[model samples]
Target: MCVDSPLPHLDRPFDYQVPAEAAAAAQPGTRVKVRFSGQLIDGFVLERAAGSDHEGKLSFLDKVVSPEPVLTPRVARLAREVADRYAGTLSDVLRLAIPPRHARAEAAPPAEPPPPFTAAVDGLAWHRYVAGAALLRALADGRAPRAVWTALPGEDWPARLAAAAATSLAAGRGALIVVADARDLDRLDAALLRVLGGPGHHVALSAAAGPSERYKRFLAVARGSARIVIGTRAAAFAPVADLGLVAIWDDGDDLHSDQRAPYPHARQVLLARAELEHCAAIVGGFGRTAEAQQLIETGWAIEVGATREELRRSMPRVVTVGEQERARDNAQAAAARLPTLAWRAARDALNAGAPVLIQVPRRGYLPAVACADCFTPARCAVCSGPLALPAAHGVPSCRWCGRPAADHACPQCGRRRLRAAVVGARRTAEELARAFPDTPVRTSGRDGILTSVPGEATLVVSTPGAEPLADGGFGAVLLLDAWAFLTRADLRGTEEALRRWFAAAALARPGAPVVVVADGGLVAVQALLRFDPAWLAARELAERRELGFPPAVRIAALTGPPAAVAELLSLAELPPGAEVLGPVPAAEEGHERMLVRTTRSAGKALALALKTAAGARSVRKAADPVKIQVDPLDLL
Candidate 1:
């Protein structure tokens, strides 16, 4: 049954007396339909105990939903902790651990075999590698390593992790690697497959993969066949037996967290699994997020760093764009283009027969725009819509509601013309194409364009998620528009922006011009210039510590329906000095959301409130269907 049920806490299991016919099917871990409080609820069979607390008649199990019992003893404990820590329901965590029953089958054949590589194991020294051989030794024993966390930096991170996958099988243990994006997983898998010649060495698992592909990979893990599994966030709970390693690449990426029930992060899940199952964890990234640094600081992990000389040799040329101002027609354009220095750098790289990489913040044509007169974004009259520039034809439209002919005269003014409020990848690509009419400009961005044609004077423009040019290397990386990411009012905005810059810079060849366009005095830029991620992490952590943010403190954001959310807050048992900050209305219309802020002890306090508050008659909240996010990546 769902762990939130009052049965287990009541010190007795309900004697939903099963008949002899269905007795064999009603095994532990088997899901069943049971009548609880006049409602049919889905539950897992914990055990068949021979007792009851009440004198009333007992209910029989509706039937065993599935014969497969996915809830392992180890997973059960971890799921419980995950629920308690996040102030969520056990079923929520379980949902993430186990996929849909229909996805449990193998539907596709194996992929073509990859060629094997012959590397002398003994000749390879540990110092040159980011991953430790000791981790290899531990995974060999079917036991996980207990290192806290030591993040890896550099563009070769994926290749190094692929090498890690190679070590797993030789050690007689399987591997499960989780990354932020499908691109990352594909990169790691391709690198590993280059090392593993066989067809069954690895498989990709993601929603993007067809049902057949996902099913095949899932079956391989569950059946203890596939030794190495690579996927996006969902691969965290891959049922690989004797799991030697669970490497999570770029743990700081928001894509690693599940948006559904339990809201568990792959990094958090890996940490818990490593502790519970005694597996080694390798969380690597171009930038050292505070969460990873915390593991090293707490002595839970050992520090691994590149040599100072090697680091310097691999470092890119750093530049700041915010210090300079452009005097086009002696006035600043509402939509800023590339700084002259950055443009020159790109021009030089192209002149040298090398492609240039430009990183922008948003996608589509004029994603954000402002009024020329009022200097605020133009909106639709009837329904507020974000106005955008016309791309295909001469007609502009509302980007929000997609109202055709959004060329409406502003209600505030009689003027029909609206200025382009924002500069998107599309608009910038078009503008840059116009400026460099002689050069071949192509977009390798989120609009679904993967790569561009290779040419000396090629301008490869892109958005954040669709950063390309990593296959080989870029001659110059133009980190444009510092204000876009820095101005975001989120907790990890700067951290994320820095990470993106570092990753894009890493894609550039050593000593290549990595022109950064940001305020010179900005701490993130300074930190990158110094190539000191730890310094940045520690400083950022200090700010969070003073503000009672995560790492120094744990804050849980509980969100749900309005009346139900409010009722839960009122009935919650908060501790002394702990505070309930908000039942204050959320910006989301019709949603009665609340913020219950407190110390780390708030985990328990919030749990108590949810369990009791869900019992209210008026709300009928259905077991506190609140979304609890711990150490949330996006604080919006």
Candidate 2:
């Protein structure tokens, strides 16, 4: 049986004897209870045998948890492959694959399908792309074709995905669609229902819904009742029967990265699933990541996107406010965070009876506070924690401990006065409100995001990912605090920054002005102006290749206490050409981090080596635990 044990040493399955009374229910794919270490544990029955292969007496089954075979042969095989690929335990992968079975959900009556969207697929954005038709043909004919799609700004990508899914469903095969987040899922789910004609045709799986709802959807997919599945990262493992296609939208988004053990990304997981299941794969997004580019470069996937002429016509007009222009008006720079050009554009947009979007990088009233006198960061007088304002004009308080800083004074400057080191969404909204007192200003961010802004003239101040769509799209978009995104310590900072900017700008109506306050000469900013994520991605990949960084080379990060991490690395039997960098101090006290780099061909071997080393440590009962992350999004 495949035991539900997360131990590295117990990765493989063990044989167990089925009692005569429970022999009928102990079939393969059924969840069972087994006696391990004198304690009952859960396990999935792989197969039943007439004869024992062991020389010694086998332990009898503790109990049969369920007669339903939730773990299908395909899912079981896929889970095993995923575990091996990530060097993770089977149990962890299975935990992702199969949620806890809810009996009430299993017994629930089948839901009738919703009305199908009978709209024709002609004139869809995907039809404008070169390889789009070919991809659809492959899915329709049950031919496995892989492609990387770059969606144009304001494109109805969900409709395109639904059209592709319809093609698969027309055939005798099923399709699985994985998006980055719940927002995308909601959009795609509604679109898919419209195209495919109902809830009976496809099931939407996401943790955003209640447990019962999620379980019911999962049950439908597992029981082969629903041939199409759409969901967030977790849906990548959906057990749809006769899978024909696996498509992931916005693969560059961090939400696609799994937060659980082994931390498998939705893109990578879908890629592996396609290869293993012999199905078509599509990685579609507005901005291409280095990893997706690598797939195209390696001929693993074909590129599908609009032509340059089409891209130019589809994108909004972009204007850049460079440092030179800002320097030309020092008073404007000192007196206002928004450049004069951006202010003019927003004013013009509002006057034109259209809403304007202001994209900020941070949220809250005062994200960062500093001393007014010496320009040093303000800290809590008692706890020494960083101080911040919880609300507009509110008293300063320590962000860490929530202690009020009413009587606090700056240590370095010895001043009681404080300044806004970093302006946030609320602060930006406050300033914009004051600047345009007659115009209505709305705020959107972590506190509560707006799905759609009220129509007509208003200024919508939002952080990245919180920009709401206007009725007819925003008349203008102002990308503020460009330096904040550009100055992030992560390796993908530039790529991420461009993505955030592009997403907000994409909301603006075509021909409407989009003003960016950043370095115009920078490649990322230039790409935004040109509306070319492919160009930026290609450039980023070239630089990474030259530096021997990730996407060019596979890298894993190991973090733990200095001594334990060092010891683990020392014991690792890495693949040839492996390079180890740093035992640098980590953000957490007493912890350190290191990176192991290797060629793409050697990534599996490297992962296996680390897994084996970790298993050895586990067997030895090591006190310090090391965390290993492969292809981590944040490499700070």
Give the best candidate by lDDT.
2
Candidates' C-alpha lDDT: 0.68, 0.85
lDDT of 1 by residue, 1-636 (tens): 453253212212456777777788877766677777777777777677677666998777777776655555566677777766665567767677766655335334434433332342231333453445665555455565554333333346666677666676667666778988877767777777676754566778888887655765676666555668888876777777777788887777888888875577888888877787777787777787888877877777665566667577767787776736543542213123767677777878878877788888778877755666766667766568777766745566677677765556656666676676667788788877766777777786755866434536578888876766543467788887767888899888878888877777776766778878788888888987877777788788888879877766666566777766665667667666665556655556655555555676565665555544544422453553555565566656
Alpha-carbon TM-score of each model against the true structure: 0.87, 0.96
Q: What is the lDDT for 412 in model 2? A: 77
Number of the top-ranking candidate, with TM-score as the measure? 2
Compose the digit string of candidate 2's lDDT tens values, residues 103-203: 89877776654344343444345578998888887776789999999888877788898888878877778899998777788889889878766568888
- Model 1 score (lDDT): 0.68
Query: In candidate 1, how many Å is residue 155 off?
Result: 2.9
